[model samples]
Structure formats: C-alpha cells, structure tokens
Target: MSDWKVTHSPSAGRRPRALSPLREHLRDTFWFAPATAMVGVFLVWAVASEIDTRIVEALQDRGDYDAVEELLKVADDARTVVTTVSSAMMTFIGVVFSISLVAVQMASGQFSPRVVRIFVRSRITKATFAVFLATFLLTLLVLTAYDSDPDPRLVTSVPLVQSLVTLVMVALSLLLFVMYVNTTLRLMRVGHVIDRIVGEAFGAVALLPVGASAEGHALGPETDWIAHEGRAGVLRDVNIARLVRVARQHDVVLRLIPRTGDFVVPGTPVLAVHGGRVPPYRALRYSVSVGVERTFHQDLGFGLRQLSDIALRALSPAVNDPTTAVQALDRIVQFLAALAPRPLDASLHRDRRGAVRLVQPVPGWAALVDLGFAEIRGCAVGHPQVTRRLLAGLDDLALLVPEERREPLLRHRALLAQAVERGVPEASDRTFALRPDRQGIG
Candidate 1:
C-alpha cells in the first residue's frame, strides 16, 4: 500500500503545466484545426487517388492483373495522407474557433480584456468541434467507399446530404449577416439623432421630460459616448415650452396650438403636457439610420465623417447631390441635441407674473442665420440657440473647405454680418432671450 501511494503521490506532485491563454483558446477549436488540415491532406490524397485509379483502370484494360497486384502496396500511402489532412484541419479549426469566441465574448460585455475571459468559450465554439468530427467521419467514409465496389445507394445518399447541408449553412450565414447590418444601422441612427439634438440643434430638448435618444451616449464611435453606454443629458436650457417646441419641431405634434382668436385675454393656460409626449423624438432619432448608404432624407449625424463614404456610395452612385445632403443637415442638428445638458425648469416655473423679460440686447447676427435656415427649410426656427451654434460651427469650419466653396457658404455669413451692421428687430441682443411675459403679441 505504501509503495502504491508513493508512486501516485509522485505523479500528483508533477502536475501538468497550465495551458497558455492562446493554447486554451485553441484547445476546443479542434474542429477548425482539423478542417484546415484536412483540406491540404485531402488535396494530396485526391491527386494520388486519381493517379492510382487511372493506372489501375489502364492496366486492367490492358489485362495486366499481375501489375495491379504488384502495385497494391501503394494503397497503404492513403492512410498517411488522410492522417496528415485531419491533423492540419484540426489545427486550423482550433485557431479560428479560439479567436472568434474570444472576440465575440469580449464584445458581449464591458469590453475589458480580463472580465471578458469568463464568457470567452461559447456554444458555437464547442459546436465547431462537432463539425470537425463530422468532417473527419465523412472523410473516412469517403476513403472507405473509394476502395469498395461502387454502390449506387451510397453514392446517391452521401452527396445528397452534403449538398443539403451546404445549402442550409449558406442560407443561415446570409440571414445573420443581414440582421447584423440592420441592427448596426439602427444604432447609428440613434447616435446621430442624439448628437444632432444635443450637439448641434439644441431643439432636440425643447419638449421634454422624455429627451433625445440616449443611445448616442453609448455606442456611436471611438470617443463615442455611445460605445461606453454613458448617460448624459441630450439637451441644454431645456424648459417645458422649449421642450414642446423641440418636440413639435421634430414632428411631435400634440395639436395644442391656439385656433383663430379662441377667446384668449391674458394668462390663458394653452398647453398641457405629460411625460408620454417626449420619448418619440428620441425613438425616432434611434430608429433613423441607413447601412452604407446616404438617403435623400439623410442626417448630419455624429459619425458622419467616418460614414460619409459609405453613405455617399450608397446614395449618389452617380453624382454629388444635395437632396441626400440636406438629410444629413437635419441629422447633425439632432445628434448635437442628444448631448445637450438638461436644464432645470426653474425658469419656466419661476414667478414671472410680471417679471418675464427680454434676454438682453446684443447684435443677433446668429439670429439672421437661423432665420435664413428657417426660410430655406420652411420650418419656424424653433430655438434661436440651435441656429446660433450651427452658424458658429459653420464659421469655424469654413476655413477647412476650398476657396471656391467658402465664398458661397460665406455669403450667408456676409448677409448676417450686414444685418448686424444695420439693424433687424429680432437681431437685437435683448430680443434673443425674450421672456414669455414680455412678449408683445401675448
């Protein structure tokens, strides 16, 4: 008993070395390795088998049975070919299975190199081994059949099954590819909507308790808050009425506007809002995306620079067109709005019974741009701040373009500058932040 125990203890003490991460990743990828190895081995085997068949058939036709018998020893070489083929295929399969599993698992979670390891091995990786085993069995069956007398039954069944399986897998892969593309597009649209609403337009927030699509804060791009799934307000200076205007501007129609002289003296509570009214814009923002294509109703989204090529290729296949470009303009407005910080509605609820007053007196050159945009788009410039910021961005980026394009773009700037030099009532600094109570019409 002591001798037996001593031998077992010695073996236990010399435990096997732990596998490296790479080895472990490839450990269950036995199928990929085998599949790859088999391809090469099978190629050699096929060539040899063809030569053997030709020689044997020719010799038989020539009535040389004795030569066929003499050359029979060559058949043993088939084993070497098959074995090498299987080993090579197993090795290749292991590598791909390991890599694919690790990548997908890493993508599924927080994207850390460490925590991702826990879920690294998945059902697909394990299933790959089964596929490899099936392939090996099929190879063995084929080799066995080649040596045996041809049976019409085996011939019809094996090839039919192989064709069916190939067809099924091809169909499945195509379906998955389409689904992945669609989902990615949807997420992109969400990011753009949020960015336009928060980053550029600022009107994305005019309506709500509900706000711009928070999706942009998560998965948009590299520095993309969307990828990290961070939560930030998608609006700034967002009061309830501004929120309403923001909503209405984006087609969040509640039908609460006044009709012709609906008997209003002063202080008539016109609109009543609930939380339900706000999420539509956010939803719409998240839902509006295209895959590798720009649309006539395009968006000036967060990741447009990266996506422009795919979009333009998809949209204009022939010529550069502004019809698709205008959609991008709206998208830009929405994406920026998604990042705007939410303001406390303190101003809205403030006791302005008589205190509602004008914002301040400053030359509203920015307002002039907003007005021009409003004229071109045929939408009331919902919020002046959004238009102001857009103009500022245009002015800042003007130098990036060629001298020729700059002149045309700057013509609007020139017009605004002229307005500032002269005087428009809306262009007054005081009128920019006009208080509700101070409205001349109301």
Candidate 2:
C-alpha cells in the first residue's frame, strides 16, 4: 500500500505563496495593458504631429504649398476629418462595450459564471478595445494641433498623414468589432465552451513534471504540519520549483496537504514538513497562493468544476436542458480518456540529485471520476436523455481506460443504474434507460 498521505495540523502557522497585491490586482484587470498602450499611442501621435508641422513650415518657405495646392487643401480639411472620426470611434466603442457586456451577462446566466473570465481575457476582445481607444486618443492629440488662429503662410498643416492613419485605424476597429461579436457568440455555445474547458484542462495536465511519483515517499517521524494563516480561499497555485529548492536546502520532504482547487480556512493544515528541522515558516508560506476563486493556471480540477457547474445548471428545474448536460458529459469523457493513461498518482518532486524534495497531493483517477460524474449523475434522476448519455459516455470511457482505471467507471455505472431504478419507475422506462445511447434512446 502507498504510505503517501496528507497530514493536517491546525496550530502550525504557514501561508501560501502569492503575487504581490499590486501584481495580482493588475492581473485581474484586463484593461491595464490596453489603457497603457492607448497612452503610448497618444504620445506617439503628438510627437509625430510636431515633426509634421516643422516639415510643412519648411515646405511653405520653399513655396511647395503652391506647387501642390490639392495637398494643401487636404491638410486644411484634416482637422475636421480627424475630429469627426474620433467622435464617431468614441461612440462606436461605447456601443461595442455595451453589447459585449450584455453578451457576457447572458453567457454567465446561461452557462457557468466562471466563463465570464474567458470572455474578459480574450485577446480579440482586448485588442478591439485597444484599437478603438488608441484611435480616439490619436485623433484627440492631432486635434490639439489644429490651431484656430494661424498665420496663413504657416496654417498649421492639418497633419493630413496622421489624420489618414486615424481613418485607417477606424476601419480596422470596425472589422475587429465584427470579429469580437462572432467570438462572443461562439463562446456562448455549449460545444465551444466545453471544448475550451477540455483543452485547457489537458494543457494544465501537460505542465506536470514527467515521470514524477506519488507512491514511494514515506513520511518521517519528525514531520511537522504547517497550518494556513490567512482568510479562507481555494488553493490556486504553488511555486513548486521554489518549494523543491527550499526542501532540498533544508533536507526535508514537504507534503502539500491540499490539491490546487481545495479550499483552506485559517488554521487548516496547508503543508507537512518531514525532516529533523522545519524550514522557515515564511519561506514555505510564500510558496503557495490562495485566491477567493479557482483559476486555470495550475488547478486542473477547476476546469472539471466549471464543466460540472454547466451540467448541474442544465439539470436544474428552471433550465431543464438535458441536451446541454449531455453535451458537457461528452467532453468530460474526452478529458478523462486523455488523463487515464497519465501517472496521476505521481506527486513526488525531486531535486537535481534525485532526492525527493516535495510531495503534493493530486487528484487520482477515482477523485477525477467522482468530480466529473458524481454530482451530475445524482442530479440527472428522471432525465432519460441525460442518464442515457452519461451511461454511454461511461461505456466510451471504459473502452479507452486501462483495466485498472475502469473499476471506478464500472462502480459509478452500477450506482447510476440504481439511481435510475429509483428515480425512473416504469419497468419499460428502466429497460430503455439502461441502454447506452448518446442521444438517450435506442
């Protein structure tokens, strides 16, 4: 049997590693980067306008304005064109923002609220906002150069080139607005959302260190439990490399008590140090990060949780959308199929010398199976479509999963049958329910 286990100690003070408050704040606010870029755009336009003014003055001194009278007229009209474009872009941005917000709200209410983060973090959405804001700022800067009172000989050349550039930017922003709307609409779809969640969950799985083991490490008698010392929140991420380094230096094995998405309250055991002397409490504490909600950064379970939320919501009496639940189950099967062959029991981390330094708990095959299917199955009761699809999904997983990992699927299948037997009363209905069909019928 594996001696690996998580030890909890409530009295030992420890904190989880986290970014500085400012850095974390900035990360949550997606507008910061685009806002900074807009300022840069404004400054660049202002400087370029000054240079254009000097060039125009020199050209007039050389009597170039008379030689290119058409170009002179275009420059004279540049301010009006820029002002009009800037005002129009400002109005367009407001409309786009309003529409985007409504889409986000609808997605949140229809799907899972957690998906709103996906919309907010979308690069296309951010880029659209940045381009529109930059165009507005650029035009405003150029407008400042349009002097009402100017010497006729040096009529502050309207920065015609800059105004034309602003027009080009306006066109680009319009195209992006269309693309953004399309992307937002796609995000609202059940299939797209499930695919995205599955993709990201697999991506997180890929980040795990290859060939790491979770079963061999044995706890020493001198192990000291380190308790959490902050407000309650989900464990989001841990600086594993740093924890490994600290463990190596202290010649100890640090066992992280909670998986990434596990919630921890004050005085809960966060880590267990197995060595003669515990490493500095602060060092261990600073290596783990806790947040109010789970993020996809290193928390693979979070994606599963989000998918489950979507299915649960679909199963709700108010929604009564079994097809959506069935859709979520299909993706869950895919995620688990991909994960079944991986070394999920492996949590041991070693330093360069091959000595175990850190031992963190990860969800094993059984836990993931439960996370993926248990709640949704319980709620799936009389919904023949959802129950049939789930059994079908389990059957699909059983074919893909190794013999050792198939036990949980089989066990869950038995339980699902029992639940269906109880919730769905008619014998003929029960017989049809047991049939594995993706569409919930023979």
Candidate 3:
C-alpha cells in the first residue's frame, strides 16, 4: 500500500554486480561529498602554498620591486578576505542547510517520504554542500599560512596563490548557494517531483533485462532455500552477475526469493537454489544488498509506487486536492504508456555454457497496471476530475499497449465506470466522469 513497501514471497532482485551497501550508503548520505571536499581542499591549499613560495622567490631573485610590492599588497588583502570568508562560511553553511532541511521536510510532507531520496541523490545538493565546505576549509588553511610579522623581510613569502584559490572557492560557494535554493524550490512543486520520479523510472526500465516468461517455468525444483543473515531491511538490489557466476560455479540456478523492493528479514529465505551443489552462504549473502528503505537503484516498480503515493495523498480527506491528484495521474499515465510496449516478464541469466544460472521474476503487465491504477480508482470514487483522469489514462494506455496487455486496461476502465455510476448519484455527472478527457475535464 505504501510506496515500495509491498513484500512478495518470491520475485526478482536486480542490478549490476558492482553496487554494494557501501556504495549505496555513499549515495544516500551527505557526508561523502563534504568529506571528499575537505580532503581535496587541504591538498589544493598545500600545492598552492608551495607554488606561492616558488612564485615569490622567482620574483625577488629578479629584483622586481614593483611586482614584489604588488604581491605583498595582494597577500595582505587576501589574508583579510580569507579571514572574513572563513568566519562567514560557518554561518552560511548553518543558515543555508537549515533552510534547506526545512524546505525538504515541507516537500516530503506535501508529497511522499520516498521523495526525500530524490533530494538526497541530487547532484546539486551534493555539489552545494561540497563547495561550501571546501570554501570554508580552504580559507582556514589559507589563514594558517599568513605570516604574523608585518615586516616584509620577516614575512618570508606571501601566500598569494593560496589566497586567490580561497577567494575562488568562496565565489564558487556563493554561486552554488543560488543554485541550491533554486533546486530546493523546484523540488517543492508537485509537477517537478512527478517528472523526476518518471525520469528515474525510465532509467530503471532501461537497465532491466527484457525476455520471455517461459524461462521462469524452465527452472527445476528448488533443492534448498538459503536463509538471509545479518540485519533486516528492504532488499534494494542484487549483484546479478555475481549470483549467476556463483550459481554457474555450483552448477545450480539461483532465484531471488523476494523482489528488489521487498522488505526482507533476517533468517528469511533470500534465495532459492535449483538443483545443484549448494554455493557458499557467504557468497550468496555478499551478492545481496539491503537497506532500511527501498531505492530506485533497481526497483522498477518504485516509481509507480511513488507516483501512486502522491495521488493517494492528494485524494486523502486531509488534503482533498483533486487537481494535485490529477497531476500525479498525468505522470502515472505517461509512465505506463511508455512501459506498455516493453516486455514485462521474468528474465533468465545464463552462463557461458548456455545453462540458466539465475532466474529473475519481473512484475507482470497486469500487476504493474494494477499498481498504477487500482488504488487511485478506489479513492477517486467521489472526485469527478480524478475519475475522469483515470478513465482518460486508461484510454491512453489501451491505445499504446498491445492487445494481449489490453485486458487489464479494459477491466480497469470498466471498474472505473462502475465506481463512478455508484459514487455519483447524478446521471449527468456520471456521464461526464465516464467520458475520457486526458486533462481530466478539458
């Protein structure tokens, strides 16, 4: 019912073998960017300080009094600028991130909690944080290089290059601040959020392996079910290549016991080994990645789940916003129309020997159709705009999808008609609601 929290007894886990919990951790957290930035800032300051020393020595050896005096004056101004930048940066970080968090919270509340991950994975947000911290740290390093003595003879060499670099970092941080605020504002808009979710869905669909369902039936009886170990959470993704390679090595087929977005508990059977020597438990566990919440990394249905959540929230009595629900439905229609033509069946991973090593169960067309519309239709009973949009969405999908996949679409269309007939007492309203309008009315 909630976004990506549905648990299926046995379904596919997918993605490349290179991804792991650590990688996911870095992607989902804010620390990695800032930490990397700090380290980079230190290295840049060290190199720049060395270069400044070299530049100053070269100028003095040439006895260029004019250039040396100019450099000293620039160095003095740089020190003052660096001190001011360093002092203001901490406050800037606090104020900027504080406002950002509040805005993010408001957006999450207005949309769905799953939306938070989008902001977390946002390149702008990460870059903003990285630049801000880099500017602050670079300034600090530059301040440390300033000589205490005002005398030019005792000053040794001025940190001309370091100061310039620090100033550049400050300018970059300010520029990113503007961009960060703009991105945060866009995140709050429902239309923008839906578009982003749809974009992620398309990206996920591109990575999914398309094939016939016959392979799912070709697998032999399961010899053993491998129990999950360690902490409990949602099965975010699996290292499919590794699983296939391991299965091939053991002369068996490994089928994931749960889908990528399904919540998995410790001691649960995470994999089903079909007819061969059992592979090592450690290898199996290592290939599976779990997290506290579902991610778009591999979960194809997660996008639909998020869109559905937004629609559901909009239709709720607390919000009672039909226009928002219609917007959400607009995206839902777009997503399904794009997905309707794709092969929605289980895919088989085979070894070099032409034997099936892994079987991944993808969601059937009917299931996806149901996930996208069934709940919205039920909640849309009283709202004519949403009801009309549902009808229009179903009509759009009916035209785009192949005949074999149109049965569910037709069935949903009938269900919507029936719901409108019962929910709307007026004959005219029922007729209007049943009429297909892509914009829900106009």
Best by lDDT: 3
TM-score of each: 0.24, 0.85, 0.91
Q: lDDT tens digits, residues 1-442, model 1?
A: 0110000111111222223223433532345554654464455445544555566667677776666554443333444555454456556556654665655453333111222222222333334444454445444644453443233222211122222232343344345435544433332342332232233223222322233121111111111001111122221111223333343343332212221112333334323222223333343232111122211111112133322322232234343333333343344333323323322111121111211110101112233223224332222133333234335534543544434335544665454444433443454642551212211122
Model with the higher lDDT, candidate 1 or 3: 3
Deviating ranges (above 4 Å) for candidate 2: 1-28, 50-54, 57-72, 152-158, 209-222, 248-252, 276-286, 350-355
Report the C-alpha displacement of residue 293, candidate 2, in angstroms: 1.0
lDDT (Cα, tens digit) per residue for candidate 3, span 44-162: 88899899878777877777757877778888877787888889989989988898899889988888999999999898999999988889888878888876666554456789889
* CA displacement after TM-score superposition, residue 44 of candidate 2 (Å): 3.3
Once all C-alphas are superposed, what RMSD does model 1 give against the true structure?
25.3
Candidate lDDT scores, in order, read 0.33, 0.76, 0.80
Using TM-score as the measure, the top candidate is 3
Clashing pairs in 3: none
Output the lDDT of residue 6, model 1.
Answer: 7
Q: Report the candidate with higher TM-score, 2 versus 3.
A: 3
What is candidate 1's local distance difference test score?
A: 0.33
Is candidate 1 or 3 superior in TM-score?
A: 3
Which of 1 and 2 is the better model by TM-score? 2
Cα-lDDT of candidate 3: 0.80
- lDDT of model 2 at position 310: 97
